[model samples]
Target: MAQDDTPSAFRLPDPAVVSRTMADVAERGQRIVQDFLKRQSDNASNGGGTGGAGSDPLNLAGAFMEMTTRLMSNPARLMQAQIGFWQDYMTLWQHTARRMMGKETGAVISEDPKDKRFKDDAWRDNEIFDFIKQSYLLSARYFQTAAASAEGLDEKSAQKVDFYTRQFVDALSPTNFALTNPEVLRRTAETGGENLLKGLSNLLGDLERGKGSLQISMVDRSKFSVGENIAVTPGSVVYQNELMQLVQYNPSTEKVLKRPLLILPPWINKFYILDLRPKNSFIRWAVEQGHTVFVCSWVNPDESLAEKGFDDYMQLGPYAALEAIEKATGEKNINAIGYCLGGTLLAATLAHMAAKRDTRIKSATFFTTMVDFEEAGELSVFIDEEQLQALEDKMNKRGFLEGSEMAGTFNMLRANDLIWSFVVNNYLLGQEPFPFDLLYWNSDSTRMPAKMHSFYLRRMYQQNDLIKPGAVDLLGVKLDLRKIKLPTYILSTREDHIAPWQSTYRATQIYGGPIRFVLAASGHIAGVANPPASGKYSHWVSDTAPPTAEAWLEGATELAGSWWPDWHRWVSALDKAQVPARTPGDGALAVIEPAPGSYVKVMASD
Candidate 1:
């Protein structure tokens, strides 16, 4: 008997099950809509009508308008772009038609190998999905090219246009939507529309958590706590102040380097990023390496801390920690390390101490820090006059910048990874985010004091004044980077979006002291938090300093494994006098509390 020449029917979800799921999804969606409307109503009654600071806070419209004017002026160029877009689509259509006819045809366009959005086999093997993928890619390229090619606009405006254009394009990716995404479609079919219902529930939960705004949950927050699973290194809070609490870890070795290590982490996030877990904890590793490690855990500021300024952070933070360290260890000289914003502050404090003839801090190390903000990376797109004024207005009203707002800005830097990935996992695919220590710490953002944040943005980012001698005044002392003469080590990540390695490398030219610059392989957090045991990212080291970052990289030697050992060797070489290990409260500064102190435990929502 001849085989039946009939096409098999597609597997469809049960109508009753789909109906029930659709009803539940509709109910959840309706609640979300109701909550959003109520929020808008409350805002309107409170004299907030989506105007002034509320609308166009980033001044995105102005940049896009300028780009549009520039593009309109060159009609021939615009027409040429339109023609090119159609030509690509035509090629894609031809390729897709051949694919449907069982002909082996090359793709009209392909995604970057790093692009994970189209990693599913169906995106390549299925003709319809392949066409959809290429169409999106082609359009994304067209939009980005147009934005980059905008003429007559200033550098800042051009950057804004390009950056936001990419964000818009990324948002419109087929993978972010349920109907367009093959993975989501497959999951939906397998679950019989249950995934859509769950997705709606997740969407509602996120909306409710954000109080009408969408705050996509990036990790399972229930799985981790600050002082419990993560940040579990044994230590005590030796010193506390309004701005920060200095935690002095109990030494792991019998003897430690005489010069204790004080770490000043950025106040924008908690210090536990360095102490996430024992294996990857920089704090734990440092203590094991025979160094008395002390870290400053910054407070999550509120309206009450509104008056605090950058000067207060410097004096009450690292400076206060310095005096306390002296009383604790009975040592006048010490070594210091700072990460990101903290590193910038450390550089300034070094200058302040230089003028006062205070030589307590013998060595300094900066992790992805930028003293010179001339090329401050994509973050500069948010630092223009209009946006600053708008941001100041918002902060002035609340006495501090909301942690969520700052988090959103940072997320925009790597939207595909930080923002869209969560959107797909938690909303589109109806899957809960994996339990991740780094993302948990990332979600636990800290508010910035209005005065301090304003001073930082205006001085460092907008005006680019930190690099100039006497450009910044702190506690009656002019902060000149040139005056900071301590032996310095600057570690910059090659893929750092927040602090470009080249921008951070400019510090080598400014400081009077001998400098060693090292470039590590991943982005900001992963590169810095890498452990030797993990054997993950590689780093580059060079003894000589070149005028340009590119030249420095050209002569640098690529080495395998983490840069932590290299750093330990360099810091230890500074002053390797050994002393008997001292416990947290063994010295004059008594223990106030346990490690990962109360300050870090305070959530932004709280």
Candidate 2:
């Protein structure tokens, strides 16, 4: 993993949550509300057709609706979405920490039997442990806020509140403090000086080898960048696109697959994750089973190309990528697979292009993509106007947003796993760190231009209008998911900490299309990297009519093996039959080199 000295932008201010301050503010606001209600009487009659704030039920209902309308319109509230995430994250972590430390669990760290990354130095590092602690502490403060809400009451009420409050604080204090604090540095036996380690004897060996995986800026490859090599199946032939972009090699069989498959990798991470490795890579299994595959490698954003925004991505990213696929393979449309933010972007692109009557994209495969914000989980707490303003203000100064900020925001989302875990393992435990591929890739983050970041936050998480028709405007055009009307495949892990599965499942409700929603086992990364080798890895597939996820869960029997093969089968069913292969571009669009394009090299961090 590339070494990053960058501190988190969402770093909690000193004295993370001020109990007295928050309590006082809550009381002051409450008092004002009380005064208003006390002074105002039920004088105005709603039946009189007066739109004023009357005391009638109808007027009260209208008032509530108005509040909802204003809340939606208010930029501050939208930004507050980000704030709420932290507040909630803190609370959940506090409770979960207690639960985790409690007895009901099997293994804190899941055992990945077939995962090779776990063999070398894959043990828990201080960083991961520290992240756990810090994340819990951060969540504990939110508990305080919630408890403070019911104040100035009797001794029992106060005692109940205080009991919970003190329990959380006490849980976190000396003992709890250790949970949140991830120590990254350690003392070396030889040097006798404090240094960083993670039980990574290999890292130490690599340090001795003098070729450790530290990324260096080369004038040849210098720009904000991050990179990782995922394990693709041995026999899989990964290829590049018209723009010289890296794509998994999906060879054509004499008998074309029943379901044509296309993997949609988020531009944020390298596309090879779909083809990560033989044991886990999804592409390898798909290709072996005679499925046609295409994956997109997003270009790393740079200052030179900061002008590109979400709309530009539609025109160039997935839109252009799909167009290239159709021309190259002579297929009218392909089954598209997307992961994380890429899924969100892919869904939006499909919507925007569909509105324009673009038919090249048929079925969509969304891996952990969400279109609704109503229950956006911990992510919403940070989506308030103030944060957006803070972020936008920063973006306005710079043409593009740094990958660090995006990575930071995401890391904060799972502070325990992403941020503090490394801190504790590396800093506190005095142990050498594990070098898991997914973790290594996770540490490799990419930056977004300010324009794109601001637009995404405002439009998607803030407005949440893209899921509906004519709700979002991309490149001066309206984006509607319904217009696409393509068969959509939405897959989210049951345990995904970043893009919650339930949130991703909402995609079915938003679009009136033939949708297949699958619940996979594992977190965001592990879910997509499903290979036949993972014995425990299973997915729920419902061949019957589309039903509620719960019903699908019940009716959809667990497959004996990996979800990747099942996805390929599902997609192959959607793809057109054998067609002439397209070499590259038609007309004056121009044919470029095979892919692994210039932009695609972008690692998530600089």
Evaluated against the true structure, the overall lDDT of model 1 is: 0.91
TM-score of each: 0.96, 0.62
Q: Which ten residues in a row have the lowest lDDT in candidate 1?
A: 3-12
Model 1 regions lying over 4 Å from their true place: 1-47
Clashes (backbone N, CA, C under 3 Å), per candidate, total 0, 93
In candidate 1, which residue pairs clash?
none
lDDT of 1 by residue, 442-473 (tens): 99999999999999999999999988888899
lDDT of 2 by residue, 1-606 (tens): 754434421222234234443554455445555654443433123233323322232122332344345445555744565588566566545545555575232222233365221222213333345335445445555455444444234433333344435344543432213223322211232222223222332223323222222221111122223322344332221334322253535353445553345666776566655654456666666666676666666666666666667777666667666665554555556667667877777788777776678776677788888777656665665566555775665566556676655666666555444544444444444444564656555555566777777777888787877766777777778777766588877777888867877777767777767877778887787776766776766777775444355655677777666676666667766643654322234322343434333445445544
Model 2, residue 30: C-alpha shift (Å): 50
Cα RMSD, each candidate: 2.7, 16.4
